[model samples]
Target: MKRFLLLACLSGLLSLGCAAQPAATNVPEAIRVEVTGKKNGRPLLLVPGYVAPGEVWREIAAELGRRYQCHVVTLAGTGGMAPLTVAPGASYYATYARALAAYVQQHHLQKPVLVAHQTGGMMALRAATDFPELFGGLILLEALPAPFAVHNPRLTPDSLKLPAREQLLSRLVSMAQGTFLQQQQMFISTWATDTLQQRRLLGWAAQADRTTWANIVYESMTTDLRPALPRLQVPVLLLGIWVAGKAVKPDLTHAQVQPLFERQLAGAGAGGEVRLHDTAREFIMLDDPRWTLTNIEQYLAAHPSKR
Candidate 1:
């Protein structure tokens, strides 16, 4: 009888141990934002490019957070946010922007400087144009103009048809299911210019869901921000990667891309300004966070509050 009692006690203990184990955390169903840095410092909002979650900005956020209030927002259907029930596309951009604007309003953030990358840059441009009162200035890293186009023979924009969306989604799922090394190699090949950036980006890319990844690329290729660029009312910064005399073909050169951006800025009539950085590309914050942060800090210092 004692043996039976001991066995039962052991079983109960095992069950208790099992129950104490922590369950996995569920990703949020909507947008998720993380705020860090000085509570009293000027507000600096970090906006990541399409498909990338707020994790991509960790390095920059960590550094910037020390001196400025940093708000890193992961759009709906990506990062820690829950996947969307609606088709993930350009409309998602508008939805995310509105949500972002609301977050700022709810928190009562002052006119914050928006720091954006790639497709995030496009979204920033849209937000700044549409909701000028919400922002103080704009910084675009590795920015592509509205009607963003890449002349690569290997890549073509997905068709507008619904079938194309399914095809793209399937490809993304397959890529996500690949071995870690395979996924890392794919990201490095596509975005990272050097080994260090490649390593960092690989980590960021791994955290994203396959569907979000596909949606970002599809939205980036199809959405045209050209019409809205000229309407932005804030100062702008354009940071780009400099590739000089490399045998390798770049997705787009600074010379080829800068003029397009400049033209759009001139037309926007917002009195927006553009500054070029040859040292970095689309992921400037990752490539050189210190430099990027310093530039942003200095720019904000020079531009007093318009609000």
Candidate 2:
């Protein structure tokens, strides 16, 4: 499934290049932008999840770009064709948030709206709390307002202990065998229903630095964004997935996740909305980009700019 998708995206890219056309207009190095629409608008910034790049929002961004200038941020040390390092605790989140705020100020973006996914949603919460004046609202996708209970066997404390540097290096070398393909499969099975989109996402993951993958995994396990949620002053939207049946992992129940969001929204004293999509899981955006985009559009419309 993934292989077929990869081939299709590659073919599409080649076709576009051959036809002297572009699929999407990507900013060269500017990770921030001014909001330009039919009417002046607030900037929309997208923050991606662990092991994923800003391109994960490509489809949605292109659609939204018609109405709102969109800026997709790929965290400096995450999945990119660059050297990587382990980001210390909340420092990465804080630093990126500050950088984004500074960019907004520099470009004079009107109270940018942050659209974040997975761990990126946590970072957005931290940013909104720390710099309320720099943001307008937040759209959180598949994020828990509190720390996820460490119950998944694959994400246990013992399982997350950082591998020794040398051991990690060895593992990197071994990853050359079939690790890349395995990573590709893991991403597809986890986030995508369509084989083409799965392959496109896998290609991005394959290009990521080994250290980035390890560090992201380590940070994801240790960092908890619950404390920052109560401090936010901006409006928020929490989009949670509702599994059809009892999850194989009993600890990851929808009931357990709901209270965390409700508590945070109540604490924020900000307009908040929660929607449970029963058919979707952790990667709701990837599974149904149109639905995600529609929800966001309606939210923004309902909360039109005061200016």
Q: What is the C-alpha lDDT of each candidate?
A: 0.61, 0.59
lDDT of 2 by residue, 1-307 (tens): 1112222222222122111221121222313333333345457888876556787787888788888878777765445435423234334454555556656566677877889887677667766776676778899886654433323413434444444434443454355635556645643554555777677666766665555454444344455555455556677898866452233344456676566456545556466777766566456777888789889998899877654
Please list the residue runs of candidate 2 whose C-alpha ends up more than 4 Å from where it truly belongs after superposition.
Answer: 1-39, 77-90, 150-174, 244-247, 250-257, 260-266, 269-271
Residue 115 lDDT in candidate 2: 92
How far off is residue 16 in model 1, in Å? 53
What TM-score does structure 1 among the candidates reach? Answer: 0.75
> Runs in model 1 with CA error above 4 Å?
1-28, 87-90, 147-163, 174-176, 179-190, 193-197, 244-257, 279-281
TM-score of each: 0.75, 0.72
Give the 10-residue window scoring lowest on summed lDDT in candidate 2.
Answer: 17-26
